[model samples]
Target: MATRQKIALVTGANRGLGLEIARQLGKRQMTVLLGARNAAAGEAAAAGLVAEGIDASAILLDITDGASVSTAVQTVTEKFGYLDILVNNAGILPKLTEEGSPSQASPQLLLDYLQTNFLAQVSVTQVFLPLLKHSTAGRIVNMSSSIGSVTIASEPLHQNGPKPPRLPYAASKAALNMFTVLLAKELRPEGIKVNSADPGLTQTDAGGPNAPYTVEQGARPAVWLACLDDDGPTGCFFTHVDEHVVNNPW
Candidate 1:
């Protein structure tokens, strides 16, 4: 039998780091699916990739909505049969004002961040596991942040260097990192790799225009993790800043 072609799904791929990650994966000759909450945006992003000579398509998937996620899974099943990679890159960082400090932040604020970042990611992963397991090499990359580092957060100058802690967002991603570790352990025997990728401060709308790194640079870590070899390390946290040199521990 011929080798099955790899298929990758990247959520929130209509723009920014997620889009860049999708493009890089497509450039590797794999079929790339851009998952967006908005159909038009996803379609346009996929079209852009297709114009660049990549095999790409759009999937309307709202990670926070269970129905939307199920429909996305069905679409993937019907169109591709199996998924080789899943990048949980879609998440929200409510305004910093709403998350003043760990102490001042409201319970509602933390809950909101957890819903989109931590919990939604788990739900999506669970829903997609069946398809992922069908592949010879399955990989899961969770887009995380430096702020999620409990070690760094404790230091005066955290991974972001000199930035105030984003209580809600950071906490949510920390929980996500834990999920990556636990899931990786459970899926290891199945030849599946699960890891967290910290993009650091990138030049996205959320990262701000003046942020140090470009989207191309920020997306590298996730792309690298998504395409790891059979012998590659799993159940670890990586940052684009050091490029796998440092396997961050919570």
Candidate 2:
């Protein structure tokens, strides 16, 4: 017998890692909902995926916009009845100043980062929790980062390590990780699994040109978490290479 087709939604799927993730999931015969803030970009990306014979569609989603998020959720629920997976991949990183410090970061920029990177993610997940619960195996993947590890940040020995200084972004991701853990714990009784995914430093706009990993590499961890079995771990932070749960470097 053939496996049942799973339904998945990926935020910010118009380009980069989000788009790649959508493509990979589509190849697996999953129905993909490509969520993008830009309507044209979303449609174009969906078209490209459809050209590849994948069941892909675009939905307008601006994480910071509550109305947009609600409409997208309603549309998906109406069409599919339930969502099997949700990838909270939309995030933002403000430009650093000459000092390259968080203290100098503009208040508006910090607020924007928080709105898109943390608040919007949490809001969308809460709104979709009911639909996710309707799935036999609901999965929630929060795209986090190694920079969010508080253990690594405070470690003096690792200060000279690979980690760079991205205060606002890193702090937002840390907050996201906390949400993943708390939500996983709250929803575990319902057979739902929520986890944080660290795609590593991939060559995306966020990762910059000097990033060593490719979008494919960065997307692996999220994909792995999305396709987890019933017994898979939850509320943990995982890197792309290994399923190893990241701990405080300290």
Count of clashing pairs, candidate 2: 0
lDDT per prediction?
A: 0.91, 0.86
Give the poorly placed runs of model 2, Cα more than 4 Å off.
Answer: 1-4, 98-105, 157-164, 242-250
Reference-based lDDT, residue 121, model 2: 95
Best by TM-score: 1
Please list the residue runs of candidate 1 whose C-alpha ends up more than 4 Å from where it truly belongs after superposition: 158-162, 242-246
lDDT of 2: 0.86
| Candidate 1 structure quality by residue, lDDT tens digits, 72-105 | 9999999888999999999996565666756787
TM-score of decoy 2 = 0.91
Q: Residue by residue across 183-235, what tens digits does model 2's lDDT show? A: 99999999899999888888888778898888887898888888888999888
